[model samples]
Target: MKKLLAAALTGAAMLATPAMAQADEGKIQFKLLGTYVMPDGEITSVNTDIVGLPAGTQTTASDNFVPTLAIEYFVSPEFSIETICCMTQHDVDAVSGLTGAELVSDGKLIPATFTAKYHLNAGDVKPYVGAGATYFWWVDAEPGADTIPLGVTRTTLSDEFGFVVQAGVDIALGDGGMGVALDAKRYFVGTTARWYAGDTLAIETEHDLDPWVLSAGVSYRF
Candidate 1:
């Protein structure tokens, strides 16, 4: 009887090993995604309009699609910390006052972000909600065609800090550590646009840069 009990205990241990290993494998997840960035570049207020913008001056930022990489570390079964990396380019155009005119050209930005997420598991699917902070890093920009014609030789956007709210889901493909991911985030941010003619500041405007970021792709956990 003693020998039989020992054999049963050993078999139970063997049965549990694979489950333990699988749990450990999901501590880190890496995702490759295609992201859509849409921003509202409306002029909230014009601080300095030396170039004489009209009364109904307004702007809109062009939407962009870019490749994004996300990395997540599971703090527990239901909690994770995640960060994403990507660079998106955009152009700001006048939609009202000087209709169809470009005001800022080829502005490149990197949204450096971090979030703490709470995940809920249901069968093979996990849904999550997160809130985070972001810093809009303006890497490069130039005066638009219309602005350049207006003695605008340089243009710069101020880097600012903002907050973001996110929601997403992960669908497991199989018992393997691969899955599909879909995510959406809303950002609340603002920036100051300054146009320069030689060494003189020609125009300075404040803009609301609230953007909707959407992403869909595959994820792998190891």
Candidate 2:
């Protein structure tokens, strides 16, 4: 983690040293984009006695494809603050690692994020990098009727705070006011999730909700 931060700061300093011209200072940019989220980890269950499963039961969440938006305010041609938002619903299915049986057939996850980026604008091509935090409004899972009868009923994820890193490039579509952008963000937020059967607590454990979000779309500068 320390190494990563050091690398980012070094890169930013190198980009900032050229005394580049600032043509787009104070402009607001908006992007309408299609985003795809690929989650690359699992959620594990610890107290399996409540669910009748063994220890270390890992569950994998599904990927998401949706439309999203980003609003940015350029502090200067070399820097900007942006917020990315979309209300997305994801279905989560939990498969027992040991038995390979599908446990929770139904579940959902929702999230939103904000960022501050530094842009290295070199004429028609703009390359940028950023770091920020993410706030998850909702994350939960519920088992099917068959699983409820087996003592493992539902799972709920606590709201979490995580760090985010982003890197992307913007290509001029025509002139200064329009462009096409491509970016990717990695979120490092993993929190403990809980599983329950009615009023009975089933399992409590941590899971990596860390996801890599890739986006591409059109941006307009005003």
Candidate 3:
């Protein structure tokens, strides 16, 4: 029994060594970070529903304004975890062609995401790239106004699971444990558009998020 207890104690003590090594490796101190994103282009899609509807009814998708904010934790010299939260407003143009009219639908606060990243450090200028999964919860949405015959607005965009890829580099500061970093990335975001007037209208669309995000900011090493 004593031998077993000693062995367990030794094992537990051994576990602490890595944490101590990491602590000895030290970490960066931080508070807040900001980022700005630009879409490679206006994301748009044209889709139509056939079978139940009369025919010739189609919807167009468009988006505007891209921005994101991230707070980072440097777990090691080459790894870190991060959360990216963003917002966007979209304009949907629907035309029946048969009815000879159009309805314009607008604005929504989309589902946001939390992600973990692996940072790669190189030279005095550290460069890193990695991937993470994100989940979005939708908020603040409204359907389009009447601009056509029986024209209903698109209210919400549904997104399930998504894949993200990232890349960035950092420049070290002479003192104060502070440095400047430049980062960029594209997230393959996915979602469904939901429409309703008294009945349910749903169609699958591609966000083509392939956003071209760029940011320059300061980081602190604890």
Scored by lDDT, the top model is: 1
* Per-residue lDDT of 201 in model 3: 59
| Count of residue pairs whose backbone atoms collide, per candidate | 0, 0, 8
Q: On a 0 to 100 scale, what is the lDDT of residue 170 in model 2?
A: 81
Angstrom error of the Cα, residue 177, model 3: value is 2.9
Provide the lowest-lDDT 10-residue window in model 2. 17-26
**Every model's TM-score:** 0.91, 0.79, 0.63
The 10 consecutive residues of candidate 3 with the worst lDDT sum are: 95-104
TM-score of 1: 0.91
Could you say which candidate leads in TM-score? Answer: 1
What lDDT tens digits, residue by residue, belong to model 1 across residues 67-116?
Answer: 99999999887899999999999999999999999999999999999999
Tell me model 3's lDDT, rounded to 2 decimals: 0.56
Candidate 2: global Cα-lDDT? 0.73
**Steric clash count of candidate 3:** 8
Worst 10 residues of 1 by lDDT: 17-26
Model 3 bad stretches (over 4 Å): 1-34, 38-67, 93-106, 145-149, 200-210
